[model samples]
Target: MATLNGSPVGLADMQALALTNYGHFTTMVVEDGAVRGLALHLDRLVGDCRTVFGAELDPEWVRECVRREVSGCAGRRTVRVTVFCPGLDLTAPDLEARPCVLVTTRPTGGVAGPLRVQRRTYHRDAPTVKHVALYGQIRLRRAARLAGFDDVLFAGADGLVSEGCTWNIGFVDAAGSVVWPEADVLPGVTMRLLRSAHGRHVTAPVTDGLLRSMRAAFATNTAIGVQSVAAVDDVVFRTDDPVVTALREAYAGVPLERL
Candidate 1:
């Protein structure tokens, strides 16, 4: 049985509920009782909720709810907190702030190795907001896994690379230039920090060939701070490459709690 808005809700029940309710949702995964980038995630949730739902939420109430839910976790584990806008009938929308749904300590498989990525053509606006409507991403991930690639990288209709199915993408070129997708991709919290601290060292929309030299690349998400990419189709990136090593070390130097 799953949970929705603090009430017991089975997966089937939630799916049925969502079919009738048209709104947004945010999911944050916390590990070891520590939620990486919790503040940023909450801010995004609130901002997105207001944008999509057109009503402000009580941050203190939401924070208290999250605290209560997280306190239920056991050891070093993963917990998912979901804030959903259940009903949005413009004619008569529900303006209340519903309880956040908390699912305690669920297994997320083991830590994954560096990913092999395949490029596709798709782009999303407002990538930072976590929404419940993710069928397109879900389908792409399934197709990628079946093709033996760990994940899929999407390019905008204009041919600019956006991001991976679930994370932000960053690359390193032969000349050791660190390149990242422009703002068209999700502004990941980890990516934001790396950019702010090392802005002068990074490049955006780097030359096309740079993708080939890609001495190193990584994807960032809330669950994983910075994960190296093993390959892009047949092209391989060395984890020990000097540039890759330096970036990894820099990322490690940042307090994990800060992220």
Candidate 2:
């Protein structure tokens, strides 16, 4: 279920990640021999490697590593690829790093529905990169869940809705256009895939005030696909909204690529 550079991952190989926690990763869902948005996922890994490690990563090698981990898997599975330098010294930081690729897989769970989230005013460090530092997001998620919410929705200091703990959020305007919030959030692969399939959509600022005029909202990611947002704080949206249904259908219709 876990491999480091196509071989079994060892505890010693995880030292740097455990101590320094400096790395980037991507989570994807692979089914049988095919993956949705496989190219985008690899592109993200390659780009994040440059940003985080100041080094180039071979996307094809990463692809083969993923394929090695998920080959002959029955049904659906969640695969995570993490890139980090195991030999990095904190005192004498090396700019030129040879990062290691760690691929792990687990059985996929049933997609949850109608997320009820609490909005918090926070933003991630290097929000654009999918890095391994997740203490802040996990803390907020735990607090939200303890307070009777399913998850957390992060907003900027100006009260603009940005993203979820691990996914991107989109809104359906009164005119039935998909409104993606323009904020410092990770450009999600699922969001891009949905945008191409959903014809009428726009990128705009989604504020707490704007949510009142919105017709409905949904969360997008590889795991849940298009999941309706039932409530944000006290505001509630209908889970069966037609626009949300259309988005789900569009995402489902997207062709899966072979790995």
Candidate 3:
């Protein structure tokens, strides 16, 4: 089921979403009715709504709606909450922008195995807000898969690895520290939670060459907590490294919040 402005909506609401696909959104994987980093997800909607639509969305209201929508699920479910203006004029943007929340739920249990990625020089706009400007990313990911890879990793013009199409990239440095790239990337909820669990994290600019020299690496996201990366455009990584195993266990140790 899907909802629009806290009310039940169907295909018409989806059509409106596609027509005005100019909003910020966030997705969380709720397992047995609990989510990790629930506050972070809500805070993301609040901050992004203000930045995109010039108005703030009440976090409590959105939280309540999300909980109500996914209340009856049995197992793991993917919940996507979007904030948008229904009657926004794209031609003449104004300050009187009021946004509402739309929540959609679906069952999910897919496993993201060790990923093989292809690097590409692509820049994303407003990397903080998770908006619907994802056609380019989806296309690139599809092309990567067709070309015998798992997904695409975005790199800067300076060859600094930023992030994946939909996941935050992490690495295990020579000193066995979790190194988070200090690039303009969407600080993902999973990565944030991982950092909280593992405090020995270093924020540094990681170039492609530096990444190749790393001990092990993995990708993090809400859907798949931590998945190892086998290779990134021919530079193979230690998929079964002890550091990767430690990260997986550390991330799994994070507690989930109810709704």
**Candidate 1 CA-lDDT value:** 0.64
For candidate 2, write residues 9-120 as lDDT tens digits: 9888877678888899999999887889999999999999999888999998998898888877878899999999887767646756999899998888988879999999
Better of 1 and 3 by lDDT: 3
lDDT of 1 by residue, 8-123 (tens): 65666455346644445444555555554567666766786676566676655655555555565654444455555444334545556443443443554454778899877776
Among residues 3 or more apart in sequence or in different chains, the pairs in candidate 1 whose N, CA or C atoms overlap within 3 Å are 37-259
lDDT of each: 0.64, 0.91, 0.86
**Best-matching candidate per lDDT:** 2
lDDT for 192 in candidate 3 is: 89
Residues 1-259 of candidate 3 have per-residue lDDT tens digits of 8888778877765776687678888999888878889989988888888788778689889878887788777788899998877666456556477787889887777876799999988889888888888888998899999999999999989989999999999999888888988899998999988888875889999987788789888999998888999889988888898887887898888888877
Q: What TM-score, computed on C-alpha atoms, does each candidate reach?
A: 0.80, 0.97, 0.95
Q: Candidate 2 — which pairs collide? A: none
TM-score quality measure for candidate 3 = 0.95
Candidate 2 CA-lDDT value: 0.91
Off by over 4 Å in 1: 1-17, 21-32, 89-105, 197-203, 249-253, 256-259
